[model samples]
Target chain A: MGSATPVDDEAALIAQLRAGDESAYEQVVRTYGGRLLAVTRRIVGSEEDARDIVQDAFLNAFKSVGRFEGNSKLSTWLHRIAVNAALMKLRTRKRKPEQSIETMLPSFLEDGHHEERFKSWDEPVDKALERAETRQLVRAKIDELPDGYRTVLVLRDIEGLDTEETAKMLGLSVNATKIRLHRARQALRTMLAPHFAASGGGKATP
Target chain B: MKCRELADFLMDYVSGELPEEHRAHFELHLSRCRNCHEYLAQYESTVKAGRIACGEMSDELPGDVPEDLVKAVLAARKLDPAK
Candidate 1:
């Protein structure tokens, strides 16, 4: 709970929010809008669309505030709504030919050995990602995943939703969610290997 | 567990979902096998790096989110009756 408000205070705020206090609405937006929009932007990959999704999410939350159980943090609840809104937009969009993940997966030989050698990236990944450029690269590689796998990974790994919640959101079975998430991480690792395995540690000059 | 078997169990191992016996086997394999250990570390790194990137992305709010989002959402709120 990164929220500054005490639990009782948040409960009161939720009451006010449900009662249609305009100020409460503004307060909710001011507090959670940026974070929600950022999540939607990652899922939808567009600022305008992300803004629209956040708007829809807030409107949905406002309309449904009575149902907000307070079992979770308000920010997390809002984050879920935003993720739903983004997924809705994704569903309604025109279909593109789906990208195959085969290219991104690692190749294995007939004898069950890796087709290529993997160099040890003994450096801590958190340290490597701390570099602004490496973080950008990480994001780009995640985006390269196919939508199904990418969404699963984003929800399960990045958004920190449990496998069950992710499966529920994606209309997938728990086993399917697990498989998709594993494949997504493996593919992402393949994409990141060159940069991390390089002796230079992907350090940015600037 | 062999390396190929360990590959299939990687997710379970990392997520702590593997059964105790399987986990022991997986750990034992990692202890002796350099390749599997490196692979496991990189797999963990992929997840760690992904989470970090997403956390950074969440901190990055585009320009429209502050004032415009609030205004638009409030307007929507006004039109709909609160439940």
Candidate 2:
């Protein structure tokens, strides 16, 4: 596979892909396959299906390479294609069982006050997040979120998609997408609370 | 603004999407409430942690393509070269 060149010089790569250059396709695959796999796997929650989705994305990109404009960075374009492929795969399948995030969300009192006090972490937030265990816990909590909320969070947060684009991908209203993203973050925070308790010294109660 | 109101608006406020009309009230409440302060900090941290976790930190790939996947795609392309 050819090494990936800088995006500013990607016109040559684009030209090669447009001409159905085998090496260009190989370079694209080698460069983007793993990132696409991670995204697809997060969305579909299955390694086998995610692999197939990645393949479909590559094939589709190859077929449409002739039409790709240089307006966006090549990586962004490929990421969108991979996300669309994952969303399509999700649409075709029977819905998998998804856990509810309600219990993980915060509770409120009758007077509109919070039912619980959120303690400041004993350690600096950045320092705490740098630990491998903390990162693993975060990923696990994200996986536990219900499908709707998880998809919104993944697309809007991790994938850095705009709200409108996320809604379009998931067939959701913009309002619904925003709400889900908020609740998903809130639920994740609730899940990490004990791990960062002021008294616990950044222990893992999870 | 009440705590529940701030809770609902935290995401928008943090993203700077909250309307200027509501920003003052939101900030005013956030300043006075210890619980909301902690909640907001925790919420922001969770967002950052998840991004780092799912992004480059945890989703790293081997530099070379997987042989099986690359071979399968190459074979498929050869069989249907016209497209």
Candidate 3:
């Protein structure tokens, strides 16, 4: 049903894998390696560690392939494996206490109005982000988020996974996922405000 | 809706998770409230900027993956008992 590889093809590949075909293993690696590495890198925050995690995920998937009854697409299964591998790496890394998100949230007056009004960001964010410098700034800002918030943002906003799937992946409830995602977005907006904000509430002409 | 009320549930509206009645009310408020409308645009811009940042991350993949990674995995496969 409208997939990159046909169901018959996937079935044949799974059969070949189950039969211990070496080429099938190579095919899986070649097909999924780039994307799996990208997903892991965002979570683990290091390209080298991401590579190691992808290798581990592939190995883990191979060991468990027989149990993979094709209830979901192979890529979906592989994506989950990569996510888990990154999480495992995160757990093993030296834990640092994350900074609280309260400091990054927008402030409202007692009367329910913004303490400081946001200036109209006249330049579309996409246009601003198209500049290499702004793109780098955005990435750095994302990295500044606490891991919990950052992971939720990456899964929901970046990877385009639905909230329920993202929640399940993180072992968080849907509500928690939404909360973290919203906070992450808010924090990111705070980080981005300086660049976008006009000094006196006028549009910052790009 | 007041600014505080809209701020409290902004994420729900953006995510399309608010019920139809709530969504209609939220939209009506946006139509009448300039401040909330701008805040909503900023919130949406944050999400857009985040996705663009992520796209850049995926775009930075090396042309060739590390050979060691593939070699190590394949070598380990040869050690598997099932094979």
Q: Pick the candidate with the highest TM-score.
A: 2
C-alpha RMSD of candidate 3: 4.3
TM-score of 1: 0.88
Q: Write the per-residue lDDT of candidate 2 for residues A85-110, one digit (tens) a residue.
A: 88877777888676777887777787
DockQ of 3: 0.49
lDDT of 3 by residue, A39-129 (tens): 6887989988998889878888998899997998997898888998788788778978888999778776777666656677868988887
Q: What lDDT does the true structure give each of the candidates?
A: 0.80, 0.80, 0.79
A-chain TM-score of every model: 0.88, 0.88, 0.84
Model 1, position B1, has a per-residue lDDT of 66
B24-53, model 1: which lDDT tens digit per residue? Answer: 998998899777787888999899898888
Model 3 local distance difference test score: 0.79
Instruction: Put the candidates in DockQ order, highest first.
Output: 2, 1, 3
lDDT by residue for model 3 over B12-82, one digit each (tens)? 99877788887877888889878778888999999999888667343444234456776777888888635
> Candidate 1 overall Cα lDDT vs. reference?
0.80
Q: How well does each candidate superpose onto the true structure, as a TM-score?
A: 0.88, 0.90, 0.86
CAPRI-style class, candidate 1: medium
Please give me the DockQ of candidate 2 compared with the native complex. 0.57
Residue A72 of model 2, lDDT score: 88
TM-score of 3: 0.86
lDDT of 3 at A47: 83
